[model samples]
Target: MFDHIADAVKLPDLVRIGDNLVVARFETMKVYSALAAVEHLLNTGAVQPGDTLMDSSSGTYAYSLALACHKYGMKCHIVCSTKADPSVVTQLELLGATVEQVPIPPGPMVDKMDLEVRLQRINEILAARRDVYWMQQYHNGFHYHGYREVAALIDREMPGAPLTVVGGVGSGASTGGLATYLRELRPDVELVGIQPYESVTFGSEPVEDPVASISGIGSPVYFANVTYELYDRIHWIAHDQAVAATLALYRDHGIFGGMSSGCCYLAAEWEARQNPDRQFLFIGADTGHRYMSSVYTKHDQAVSLTGLEPRGIRELTELELPWAVMDWNRRPYEVAPKVLPC
Candidate 1:
């Protein structure tokens, strides 16, 4: 019975963009990882049937966890951000998960502050409910293990080639986990992590009450699982760049992917131009359906596509792009986890 949802997480389609680049479209990648993590807990007896599963998510992970809990006959509770798509919240309820939506933080949409408040609220819920088991996606090692197969699948598909894996850095499970496994197979593999402009992940100067338009990637606070050593380079993509790329992707490739995926695509394109000899693989985190209201619908379609044109893409690098880029090795802050009250 567990295999029903567990089996669905394998082998996202690999779509070739041109000669040197490919986008690995994992339509439900987070859902797949969530199922894998939950199955591990169940199989190892870490969690028993009917235990309530609790976690905090911006949006994608909440839906994934809700689906996993539903499949396994467990009750689910989520501390979700108010930024989450209304559709996702509705679906979570439909799947029978209880939800607590945290209001967006005052001042700005600083993801770190928003996340910190969400985590604090999550702990408050956990403190009151001794029976619930927190999935702890941000701190859980099991979350990292779930994406090992994604790395293996990519390695199997492209053998003996120097590869650059590019993707948005979120909880760090998806990109961090994939890089961890891939590096085991090919030590020479390059990793490029992308985050939003104001994200603390890449050591960018903090904006005063900055609001982030993109979700599911970038954090105002550091996640314990985001392995800094695995990255060869890191790039920060801004809201406008992400939006422009997203519109371009839909117009050019017919791929309806979200802002994070757009960020990955733009990074991949830049990397591909730089290393024409190497194969660049970008992980498309999720589809664009959830972004219609926030991203697609709000923009003038023709204007958005036009904004992407003048960048003279082939000549652009991290410096020329709308966002900033930094070598991860030079980051001033230590990538260690901060002690938090659980």
Candidate 2:
């Protein structure tokens, strides 16, 4: 395993969605490192088969978990931020799961907040009165084990192949866990992590082409698992490049995906040109339709695109994690308490 990582390398494990289209196709789901870990947990009695599932999401993770819970006869109680699209909330509820939209985050991305921060203060308030389970994506000192199973899957499906893995980060579960597995299987393989320039970190830098628009990969919470030691290189994709990739996937391969996946593919293509013989795998986190109101429309892109307003370049390290903040609401709640349960 150590032999392959000679040049700032990573273990390759990329989970993909079929067609990578803007339209959502629940039926064509495929688990990469995360799902593989989740499935194994289910099989080994590590993850108990329960009557319910609870987790926070932006959109794609919620849908993925909701579908998984439903298949296993488990009800899903999703506590999502207000930024998640309404269609996603409606879909989960219609699928027999209860949806709780968390209000009062200062911005569009609330999941980025740390569990130790002020928003978590509100969460404690809700959990105090409610009966829902707190599905801590990470347990103890371990990154989410969901990526472990994904690693096993990669080992079986792709043996001895030099892979270029690309995807976003959230709980750092997918990034840390999968990287762990890939390194174990083939130490020489490279693992490349991706992030938006607007929210840069260890593996990223800001791009001036467009403003950040995608979701699911970047976060305020830093995981112990996604270490500099585990990664080969971190690349920053501009929001415009991401959008162009999304449109290209739709126009060329007929895959309609969010700008985030476009970032992944853009990275993949970049890697491929550098190593044409190597197989590059990428995670298509979600469809673009969820972003139709944002990246898909021309007027939306024009008004909000990078060139329009022109935000300056940022280092991934400079962007703040939402939880890095000390308070959730310094001012009084304008809308009286909604009396939400956990």
lDDT of each: 0.76, 0.52
Across 1-342, the per-residue lDDT of candidate 1 in tens digits comes to 435653564448899987889999876778767887898999999889999999887577888898888888888999877877778889899989998988866785445566778888877877898778999887787888778888888999987669999888888889888888998988878888887755556544343213343566766566777777788777777677788788778878988898888888877887798788999999888889988876788667422433242222221133343565565652334542652322
Say which candidate scores most in TM-score: 1
Model 2: residue 69 alpha-carbon error in angstroms: 2.7
Q: Which stretches of candidate 2 lie over 4 Å from their true place?
A: 1-52, 105-118, 125-131, 138-144, 152-161, 200-210, 299-342
lDDT per residue, candidate 2, 1-342, as tens digits?
Answer: 332111111123233433221111222132232244345556766556664557666466566666656566566777767667888789888777777665654654433442224346446745774544444453322335545655676667766557656666544566566667777887755666666644433433233223443455554344333454555655655555567677766665666667666666656655665665666667665567777866677634432222321122333334332111111111211211321122
Angstrom error of the Cα, residue 103, model 1: value is 3.0
| Prediction 2 global C-alpha lDDT | 0.52
Please, what is the TM-score per model?
0.87, 0.66
lDDT of 2 at 232: 60
Which regions of candidate 1 fall more than 4 Å away from where they truly are? Answer: 1-6, 9-11, 108-113, 205-213, 301-321, 329-342
